[model samples]
Target chain A: MNLLFILNKPPYSSDIGKESLDMALAHATFDDTVSLLFTGQGVWQLKTDQFAKLAGLKEFTRLYTGLDLYDIDQLFVSENALDTEQLTRDQLMVEASVLNDEAISRLINQQDRVFCL
Target chain B: MTTRFSILVTGSPFTSQAHHSAQCFVDALYSKGHQVTSVFLYGDGSYVANQLMHPANDESHPHQHWRELAQKHGFKLQACVSAAAKRGILSREDSELSGKSSFNVTSPYEIAGLGAWVEAVANSDKSLHFS
Candidate 1:
């Protein structure tokens, strides 16, 4: 259905972000032509070296690594969001396609279905 | 072109960039000749429709602005009933029961559930959320 899942929250704080990712993975595994966009606080969910032990939660970053394995590879990150949050590419685990506001506006228009979490 | 789209506002009006982002999204969509099928207010986004919001004269009135623009543009405004009730956004009946002078939720918008949101998704050609 050319679905695009946009995640706007960090992992472990709430189950919404993980549920969104799981939705994308499940849909992609079924060949739904899904894509993922990380915006705002959601960018932090892609950070590397995440250890959830201190937070009393399971490390879910590993789920992101399997995105490619399930063919949901069109991962995008808002350039403005990253810059505003002072995050560099090295701070993230996934290699994402950087997008500015104009780019994000355009990308959103291109999708058939967009689920923002 | 009768293109249909959905907007999900999940953040509070003043606390985050979601307000600006949502305004931009709605403006952009209509400017491009598309129609917003539904403006679904979820989570903190429900505050946007709070009827009691009255800012001072010098400041911009966000809630009023949204209501006017939405009504003028023929956009459907739907807030999650559960969210609104929890936040003290009473319906007409609730307002009467609580003895409020006027109902804040006076526009064409209605209070609905997630199933209604899924309905908007199903009816529209596209869905976009701002938070």
Candidate 2:
């Protein structure tokens, strides 16, 4: 099944963000088509040069590098959210397709299953 | 084909309306002859499984409602064990293992691993999350 995971939380601040990543990886491991969309504060999860280790938190953003190995390459980030946070593509750790509101809506509508976390 | 659903709750019971929203969604699904295969509670959402919860007579008890639903519909209601443990919501076995005097969770609301949540997602036709 095609699964779209919409993440809306910042990394390290809460376990939900990491758990959502785990969920996506698990689905992809089983050969399911998995996509991840970062919106709202979730855009912070992909920030470049994170030092969560200094804060005594698990560095889950490092796992994004391995997402491609798990066949979870459909990464998307909301353009509006990035703009709201004054972030740009160069600041992100991984390559993600920047999506506008309309594109995001279409992508969500095309999904067989959508999970917002 | 029967529309099989897997509900995921990631919000705390008292702090957020996610549990109530999940309950209403499940009720709607049942009324429409749909099946809810499982309800996976993660993060603070594990608090919903606390058997010690006792709300006032005027307030709606989401945990009690979930317990009743699990009993009536025979759907699996599981909370993430690690999350629950971190938040002090323990099952009988977990409580004993952790050397605790009492447990705050009971039957029909099992404390499980993330594998169980993944299994619920895999087995269902659709997965819905509330937070």
Candidate 3:
């Protein structure tokens, strides 16, 4: 199945971000076709140099670096979200293609399953 | 082709609108003659299956809606076992295995693993999630 996980929450602030990543990883582990689209506050999850340790939280963002090992390389980020957050592609911890609203919609339509968190 | 849907709910019943939205979506699917193959509750969404839930009469009872919908439509209503275990929501079998005298989840809502969710996603024509 073509599964697309749309993450819209900020990392570490709530469990949503971590849970969404876990769900994606779980699907990928089972050899399902899984993709991730980071939008809205979810873009913050990919921010470079996260200091979750200061907040006494484990750095879950580190998992994103290993996603490629699970064959979950179809990562995307919303261009508007990145711009709104004043972040650039260079600031992200992993490489992801930038997608505009139209592209994101197309991606969602193309997926057999969509899980928004 | 008839669209077979698999719905995923990951939000808490009390805190988020996910349960309400999921209920509405299922109702619409039924009205449109679409088949809802499964409804999988993950994360805090397992709370929606709690049989002990007793909301005030005036407020909307989303859990009851889920129960009724499952009964009426014969769709599988499942919750992630691990997630439900952590949240104190257990089926009768789970309660017995854990040596608990009481169970909070009842008919139409079964406890399963993430593998069940994966299967639902793979078998369904489209899967929608509310969180």
Find the candidate with the highest TM-score and give its number: 2
Q: What DockQ does candidate 3 score?
A: 0.47
The DockQ figures for the candidates are 0.13, 0.55, 0.47
What's the best-to-worst order under TM-score? 2, 3, 1
State the lDDT of candidate 3 residue by residue for B1-131, as single tens digits: 57999899988999999999999999889889999878999989988889989999999998899999999999999998888997899999999999998999888889988878888877888778897
lDDT of 3 at B40: 94
Sort the predicted structures by lDDT, highest score first.
Answer: 2, 3, 1
lDDT tens digits, residue span A15-36, model 2: 8898788778878887889999
lDDT of 3 by residue, A1-117 (tens): 788998898998777787778778878888899999999989999999999999999899999999889999999999999999999999999999999999999999998777886
Fnat, one value per model:
0.16, 0.58, 0.42
- The better-scoring model by DockQ among 1 and 3 is 3
- On the 0 to 100 scale, the lDDT of residue A1 in model 3 is 75
Prediction RMSDs, each to the true structure: 7.7, 2.3, 2.7
Error of 1 at B93 (Å): 3.6
Q: Candidate 2 regions off by >4 Å? A: B97-101
Q: Return the TM-score for candidate 2, rounded to 2 decimals.
A: 0.87
TM-score of 1: 0.56
Candidate 1: where are CA atoms >4 Å away? Answer: A1-112, B94-103
Residue pairs of candidate 2 with colliding backbone atoms: none
Clash pairs, candidate 1, are none
Better of 1 and 2 by TM-score: 2
